[model samples]
Target: MFWIDDLWKFGISAFVGTLTVFVPLLDTRTEALDPIPVVVTIPILKDLAEQVGGPYVRVTSLLSGYENEHTYSPKPSDLIAVRKARLLFEIGLGLEVWISSLVRNAGSQALRVVTTSQGVELIQDDADTHEHPHTGKHTTDPEGNPHIWLDPANALIMLRHITDALIEVDPSHEAKFKANEAAYRERLRQLQKELSDRTQRLPDRRFIAHHSAWPYLAKRFDFHIVGTIHLQAGTEPSALHLQSLIEKIRKEHIRVIASEIQLSQRLPELLSRETTARVVVLTTMPGGVPGTETYLDMLRYNVLQLVGALETT
Candidate 1:
């Protein structure tokens, strides 16, 4: 009877051990079917990926809408995110100067870098914008301005890139991805038309920009950019340039000065004090402001705010 009890104990122990090992294997298989990990340089790409990929992606954005994209420094956690990601989406055109080195350091051979700005017609700045003065590099691409996502039309192109990439990675979800992309595209077109109609009715459509970031937006909405405060990012305008802007604002009656939430408010505030032009703090990224948490929300908020300022002034 003692020998029988010992044999029963051994059998029970063996059964529990087998269950523990096999349970983890089953979990691993389920995890393999989990959402694809994605890393994007900016929030706009993250939003686009999530919109297109839906529940099929786990996306991480390196620069949360508040950071200056040109001057962003990657953190240790960013490397881990990149290493785990199968796809890394970037605005490209030299906007994210820090990304290439980060990816290299991550040493992820399985990672694929997708440039969302590819194939879209770019806007060449009449004057180049310098990178963060500390880095001593040109942030603006030699080819053109990399802020293509500012324009909803260009965002459509970006959405397409994300859609194609997601489909490539998860072919089983191809139909879902395409359907999501189509729905988003339709929403974008509808919003573009609505905003365009609103802007068309504006009596005054001219504004002085904080930086050379609005050409596409201006062109798309039929608004005019009278002057830019910072030709180079992360640097102050020369006294002479500021004086010239002041004079131009006074002379041209540029009632609205567009400034970004990501940049310092001191310059735009100073200008507002020196002139009658009101400063409207707008966001280039999706989550830069409280109400602007999505691409469509951002586009609407910016145009409406600008239009409201223009109409009031």
Candidate 2:
């Protein structure tokens, strides 16, 4: 006959053994609940992916907001991230010249590279006419400008691509992605309207861009990009071009020169000193500037800051 203590011991041992067997199973289930992994070429894409994917995605942006997208080189971690990701999002249009090689090297058979700029109408980089001092090569995209995300309308298009991609990879979360996308679109529209209303009040809307990144934004917001300081990436403008820009600003009374945080400020400042036009440093990427983390926030910040500068002049 078994004593009561023996039975108790037997029960405890059985419970322990069962737990030991099931713990890994439980851990696997928990791990399965984790979000899908994704990688994006830039911070703006990361924001869009997160907005649409919500809790369903774990996104890593290869280029932080502070880096120049044209000149970015993928780090080893970027390759690792690409290898692990189910999807990789980029603006395309030759924006990330280095991304293709990285993807090839990553050898991620499951990874889908989604070009978010697929359907949107592209703006030609007219700055190509100005010769770059170093390479003398045109930095402009032969197809179209890669800085399409600078405009809110283009952002909506990009967001749709992100939503579609997320749904494609994780169909289980389709409803969530669609719903989040709709909510984000509504908010984006509201911000666009608000900014439009504010911009309409401006008497003069001409500015000099640091680079060719602003054509889409300028077109969307009805602002005029009177001139560009650097026509090519990683190249300096000629003295003649600088003198021309100074003459243009002085002659046209171009009140604002919009400089990017990612680019050097010396030229803009020098131009400012040469003329009455004030330099308002803005960012092409989200989180490149404080109070500009979200896409909407960055849009508002850029528009409002430029409006403020234009108004003051």
Candidate 3:
């Protein structure tokens, strides 16, 4: 009887393991998948994924707007998201370095890992390769720019990639996907007009960023990044670096010290105090903060924040 019980226990364990591997790929079908557990690293992607997935799939963002997306370390819940997710969408371009490890650990080959920036042909910048603010090669895409989302023009392209993946996973909602993509693109188009109109008239387009995070936006709006507090994404600024920036501030007559909500505002705040510059919080994603819940609102909020800082202080 003891032998029988032991055999039963072993068989149950083996069977459970086998099912876990095969069921989600084969038999496990849910009523709706629009909200499939999607693990995105950025908030804008989080919003976009939810838009494309609609009511059928559930989505989750691994990195919140409050932290640096480029320098984030993976958490346990992130691994859990990978384990449960049927399809994984990432920014790619080596944006999320921890992705490979998470995928391997989850051991789910059935999981679809889609790079949202696949077709954009990224922009390249090697001049300041001394260090990069993000992961991988110091200089960004030789093919094109990784910050494709900044250009609303590219968001239309991204929609195709996102919609195609959603379709592949769940073809039943093909029409709904198309409709959703179109609606989202139209909204983005309006946002492009709103952002472009506002930035066109600014007298001085010079600003200081903690890191080189705004090149994509700068190129479109004709804004210049005089210098970065920290050139590399993860490295902290040294005292010498701070002194140099203060000097740059005086020489350039730059008034706004821009800080991202994701990184340490303490440093930016200190620099602002030293230089008599006003500190502005910029959002890199949609719904990154409480107020900037949509992509349009996110860009507007960032631009408005910058404009306000430049105008008032």
Identify the candidate with maximal TM-score.
Answer: 1
Q: Is candidate 2 or candidate 3 better by lDDT?
A: 2
Task: Write model 2 residue lDDT over 1-313, tens digit each, in one string.
Answer: 5655765877877767877999999999987798989999999999999999988899999988999888888899999999999999998877788999999999988999999999999877665475332234464425777799989999999999999998888899899999999999999999999999999988898999998889898998899998989887777789999999999999988889999999989999999999999999999999999999988899999999999998998
Q: Write the per-residue lDDT of candidate 1 for residues 1-313, one digit (tens) a residue.
A: 9856866878977867878999999999988789999999999999999999999999999999999988889999999999999999998877888999999999999999999999999877764334523234554535677788999999999999999999898999999999999999999999999998899888899999987788899889999898899887767789999999999999999899999999999999999999999999999999999989999999999999999999997
Candidate 3 residue-wise lDDT at 166? 86
Question: What TM-score does each of the candidates earn?
Answer: 0.91, 0.89, 0.84
State which candidate, 1 or 3, has the greater lDDT.
Answer: 1
Instruction: Write down the worst ten-residue block by lDDT for model 1.
Output: 127-136
Give candidate 2 misplaced runs (Cα > 4 Å). 1-28, 127-142
Point out where model 1 deviates above 4 Å: 1-13, 16-24, 128-141
Q: Where does candidate 2 have its weakest 10-residue lDDT segment? A: 132-141
Q: Which residue pairs does candidate 1 place in steric collision?
A: none
Error of 1 at 136 (Å): 7.0
In terms of lDDT, the best-performing candidate is 1
* Residue-wise C-alpha lDDT for candidate 3, range 75-125, written one tens digit per residue: 998899888887777777766777888889989867888888877756664
